[model samples]
Target chain A: MTASASERLTLVARPLDRQVASLSALAIVLALVDAALPTPLPGVKPGLANIVTLLALYRLGFAAAVWVSLLRVLGAALLMGSMLTPGFFLSLAGALSSLMLLAPASRLSRRLFGPVSLSLIAAYGHIGGQLLLARLWLIPSDGILYFVPAFALAALITGTVNGLLAARLLRRWPSSKH
Target chain B: MRLIRPGDVAVFTLAALTCGLVVWACWTQSPARTLSIRQGGALWREVSLLHNARYHVAGPLGDTVVRVEDGRARIESDPSPRQYCVGQGWLEHAGQSAICLPNATSITLEGARAYDSLSF
Candidate 1:
């Protein structure tokens, strides 16, 4: 006997729901880690949550990836108690801009450079957005300069880590689960 | 994936170059010997520096005191709980600034004869 159309839809929907729930869980965990970790630089973050972003990009489409990214930023901000401050706005700008750049780049180059490359590109975009906001709004003068090196370093480290992790996940799960 | 894109390289280089320029500009600015302290949007005290010029800044959180001497500057404030600005040293250049978040205070050093006094 052949399965009905609605049955197949339900099958697909269940996996999608599971995937979204897992992604949300990953985001919350990363946010907690970010707040708890100790770093030498003030206002500098490791952005470990980006690994989830890479996973979402590989498994889901750009829309799903974007949703994950936005939810991560907003949820992290709320959890960190920086939701309404200038820092929150700055982070929001950076996260959105990075996602905007990463979504397109991931679609274009997901096959060649794969996860690692996409992660680096996204991290770079994140730093770029932060620097732009710092120059344009926060400090407005030389503030961009102060953050450039630190941001660059962060992009390199976080991108590489997230990229490698994503690559590992993709290798382990070749077929998209959701 | 790629080593770096041309645009990314260009932008990064530009940012680095701009930082160098700002550091240079800040280094060349004049030293200030007087400091003005403010609290709650009102001027609190203006102190004149003598020998040593080492200042201990204590005030309500986010209050700023700008100390200018010769072409140098030192800022003390309560800015937020991080206290990143308090840890910063003096600034004696056109593009150098120290901000205290807890105190909502900022100190910038401007060159005496520079074209842009308002640059920082």
Candidate 2:
């Protein structure tokens, strides 16, 4: 039996909807895990959910990736109960900057550096945003220096992990050839 | 394609250098012997001849009390959901500070003299 064009479109739309829903769910889970995970050092987070952002960038393109990044930050802030404070603003700034840098990088270099490098770039961008926001909004004078070591440490650890995870996910669900 | 470009290297190098300068500044600053905390128009707490010690300040309302003794410091405040500051542990060195936002309290250690005295 030959399916009508509209029916085929519906079939396609259904998977797309499911993907969006599951991706959003994944973002929230990552945020919870990020808040719950204990670190030996204070102010350091693993950024485990960044893998979703990278994956989205590769598979769903830039707009979808941006949405994922924003959702993750918002979800994390809500989970941590820092939603309306300086911490939320800081996270938002970091997410925006990180995605801004990553979206372009993913488009240009996904074939070469793969997910790990993208993750590293995104991590660096996020820290850069936080530092900039701290200098601008919170402590204008010396607060920026306080978290340098911790932020650097986070970037190193989280970027590596996110990159590795992104690679694995990509391999599992290889991009469908058009 | 090389993901790490020359520009990335340069930016990272500059960042490293800047970080080194900050660490150096932190280490060289001396400890303050006398300090004062002010809220609004009144003195909140004033301490003189603050010795090198560790102190812990904890309370339900985020009101932080500073305990400094023999190179140990502890900060106790209403644990916000994140608890980032609580996890920061005791800050013992001079030129260090811990902030508890829930209580709007901040503690800083400085060189062993008042700012006016240093000017003389």
Candidate 3:
């Protein structure tokens, strides 16, 4: 019985490890791609990698999704040589805020708030977190607040695009019903 | 049966409302012609937009000649290597500004505050 239990444990662990690994790798690649894309303003990106997080959230579970996001933030920071820098902190803050929003949002009935709404909320949370951090540590002036309108507008555009894409992808996702 | 659900519509409406509010804030806020000259982060002078005159302000590098004309101000000349501030031409709008980095002189057009300040 013990031997069989260990075997089952390994079976479950292997697939879970693989899922986390692939999801993290995919998110990292998307993050690097987003970095390569030209942006109109500093701290603005398409956040394409977030699609992977949303997928993991909707299909796999919130825990898996959080792991993917945390790994992606750490991995992207390491790859970009911004580890332990302000940039790393900003990414970490954004990812945490995204997860914070997603946690509560996940409890809502699936029919009323689907992937699109959740994704949009996560996106806004991400931007708002980074902005708050930047204000507290970097600028600390009313001048920095002036960029709120521009940043908010960017967040809305990017959030909508990401949310719609996530929604479409989730529809085709095999186990999305979970 | 709709691909776009009610949630999607709600999100879109919320985003549109926020954008509209931002646009309204920008549009309704009048451009204040109050121009302030600063040197090394200190306020050197405040020139009223009601009057049009030329004034010389001392800066880190040397002197900057500022001219206020018809509710607009410009750095007519500066001692900087490149007359970049002069090249900026004019500062007519409330949010416009011209800076001579080398000379450590800046002219900014400031208006009334839209809000008290953004809270963390």
Candidate 4:
């Protein structure tokens, strides 16, 4: 009986932790890849890591998706030596704001809300959160508003691309029941 | 499930409209070229953004040093207990502001936009 109980924790807790950790690692790698890409603007990027987040959301659940995003931000910050900086906070704000909005939208009937819509919502929330934080703390100026149009356009494009990629991956992903 | 759904198109269209609206609104806004300083709730002075100088405004506490340089302005120092105005850093764009409630002095960047909510 004692051995079986110990096995339960190992089988359940350990696997979930490992799964979340692996997903987070994948997201961190994608983030690093994104950083290496050149862009016309400072803040605009493809946001490739969001693909993993969408996968986690669709596969495991929203809680697992949250874990992946949180770990990705922390791990990427440590790797990039941006810990506790404004950049780090901006990333965190973006992730949390996106997830906060993504949660309810995910609950929408699956027939209508797919990866594309969720991705679009997440992308917009991310930029909105970053701008809000910048206006409140860092820049504290209306100049930040000027960047909105550019950021929104970028989010729209990137969100669509990421959604398509996620959808394709989902087609091949094995939907094994836990 | 289908990769592209009608709901996705609706979301995209709505977002794109919003993007266009922001672009137009931002484009129409004239550059903030003036800084208005008020003392004890009355208009005291208006300065051009081109000026590079420091001002000493008398308030309840003491002289609050307002610095303007390189097309930006800031409350550099103050006699107040908490230096929140000083902490606000710089005022660069239209609608930016810093209020020194303890000193009864404030500065606002004006010259563009119709809505006051954006300033907040």
Candidate 5:
């Protein structure tokens, strides 16, 4: 039995790790695509890469989702040449906050919440974290808070769209419960 | 499986409430009719945006010119390096502002439609 269990871990873990890497790669590509779009204001992006993270959280669980998110943020930051810069720090803050918010959310109501609510929560957490970091480290002024309305609106719209997309993807997920 | 679960509906309702509240707060702002200039972190002067006038204020680096025309304020000229202040162009919106870090001078629109908040 021990031997079989060990074999099971080896076989299943390998495939899962490969799946995480592939998802991370897809998220990285999305991030690069988002970067190519022109933003009318700073800190405004569709954040499409988060869809992969949401999928990972639902399918592969929290740790795998975290790994995918970090890999995407790091890989994309490196590719965009923003590593170790303020932009990287902001992205890192946003990703970490979303992961933190998603952890308990997934456990609380896996059957009820679904992807839409989870996506909305994570999206708000992400933008809130980035804005807080920008206020504290990047610009030391209350003047920046004026943009919260715009940012909040953007977050709501993008979160809903991303959530819908995630829900669709979740519906199409293979039925054989992994 | 359904596209949206009961929980998704609840979340959507809550999100909608939050968005509506934000929109109301943002749009319900007083219109601005005055322009305030600050130097060295102090209130240097306040000018009426209703009148088309130009004022030259002494800045840390040199003289900076602020112009108000047709209910809009803008930094017409500045002797600061990099010309960043001048690039800000016209400030017709309530929360719009221009700052010259080198000269430590800033022009911010004020009055009825003043900002409920400012983004850094």
Candidate 6:
């Protein structure tokens, strides 16, 4: 009876798990695409991948957003063969720092903040975190500050554009997905 | 159905203002005052960028003429086949660098606040 009842201890995937998996997969795809997209300047990226995280946060809650974002970073790194590199750490730092501001601000007043504001905040946080890490471990010189303004400007543009996209996506998200 | 809320304007204004402040502050770093030249990965000399000057550096490829003026430096002429160093235009920022790899010579801009030791 025991052998029949408990054989192999079958695992069941919860709805939250499925949601997180699908969302993370989408994010990772975007991250890879962003990586392939060329920029005139080093360290400049459009960061369209974070749109998935924003959508997940709005629909599935903070926990789902966190899982989606983290998994996306890790999975993309694995696919890109950049795991454990300094570049990987930079991505992780940016993701975590942005999330630090993202959930609380979004939960505070969704009516006021919406997606654009949150995207801008995340973009700045991402750049700030990467710059700090670059100073501490990579460049190891005040010369890194030379890049602050350029990076900040890039973040502003990308953040706003991505945020707008997320807003439109959120507005159009399918009822079936909900 | 609003594309941008009132709070979105606040966020945009705040972000733009902060970015402008950063731009002004970074751009205002006292102009670079030193130009360091290296030959074969060794320190050749440090020239004053505050005034115009010219120096000829000899290498395996031949002479490389460096002209410094208007707080800017450049490889006025290089004997390297590609002329890539000469084509680099101007070196203006604190961390700007031009490496004439074939000629075994390089130049870097060094400001009061920051100096880039890495040249490539």
* TM-score of each candidate structure, all chains considered together: 0.56, 0.56, 0.66, 0.68, 0.66, 0.69
Q: Taking candidate 6, what TM-score does its chain B reach relative to the real chain B?
A: 0.73
Name the best candidate (by TM-score).
6
Ranking, DockQ, top scorer first: 4, 6, 5, 3, 2, 1
lDDT of candidate 1 over B82-112, digit per residue (tens): 7686677665444455666556555544434
lDDT of 6 at A72: 93
lDDT of 2 by residue, B5-113 (tens): 4444444455455446655554444444444443333456655534643333444464455565554454554345665556766655545555666655556555543
Between the candidate structures 3 and 6, which one is better when assessed by DockQ? 6
Sort candidate 5 into its docking category: acceptable
In CAPRI terms, model 3 is classed as incorrect
Return the top candidate by DockQ: 4
Native-referenced Cα lDDT, model 2: 0.66
DockQ for candidate 5, C-alpha atoms: 0.38
lDDT of candidates 1 onward, in order: 0.65, 0.66, 0.83, 0.87, 0.85, 0.87
| Candidate 3 overall lDDT versus native | 0.83
- Measured with C-alpha atoms, the lDDT of residue B32 in candidate 2 is 49
DockQ (CA atoms), all models: 0.04, 0.05, 0.23, 0.47, 0.38, 0.39
lDDT of 1 at A132: 84
**Cα lDDT tens digits for candidate 5, A79-129:** 999999999999999999989998888886667878888888888888889
> Where does candidate 3 stray beyond 4 Å?
A1-12, A176-178, B23-120
Q: Is the docking of candidate 4 incorrect, acceptable, medium or high quality?
A: acceptable
Instruction: For candidate 3, give the DockQ.
Output: 0.23
lDDT of 6 by residue, B1-120 (tens): 355666777887788988998888776654677999999989999998878999999999899999999989999998888988899989887778888989999998887556554355
Please write out the lDDT profile of model 3 over residues B6-114, one tens digit for every residue: 8777977797688678756655555565999988888999989879999898877888999999889999999999899999898766767888889888888877643
Worst 10 residues of 5 chain B by lDDT: B23-32
**Taking the tens digit of each residue's C-alpha lDDT, what string does model 6 give over A16-59?**
79988999999999999899999977779999888999889888
Q: Which tens-of-lDDT digit does each residue in B1-120 have in candidate 4?
A: 677888888887887887788777777665678888888999878998888989889998899888888889999998988899999899777887889999999998887653343534
Clashing pairs in 3: none
lDDT of 4 at B67: 87
Interface RMSD of every predicted model, in angstroms = 6.7, 5.3, 2.5, 1.2, 1.7, 1.2
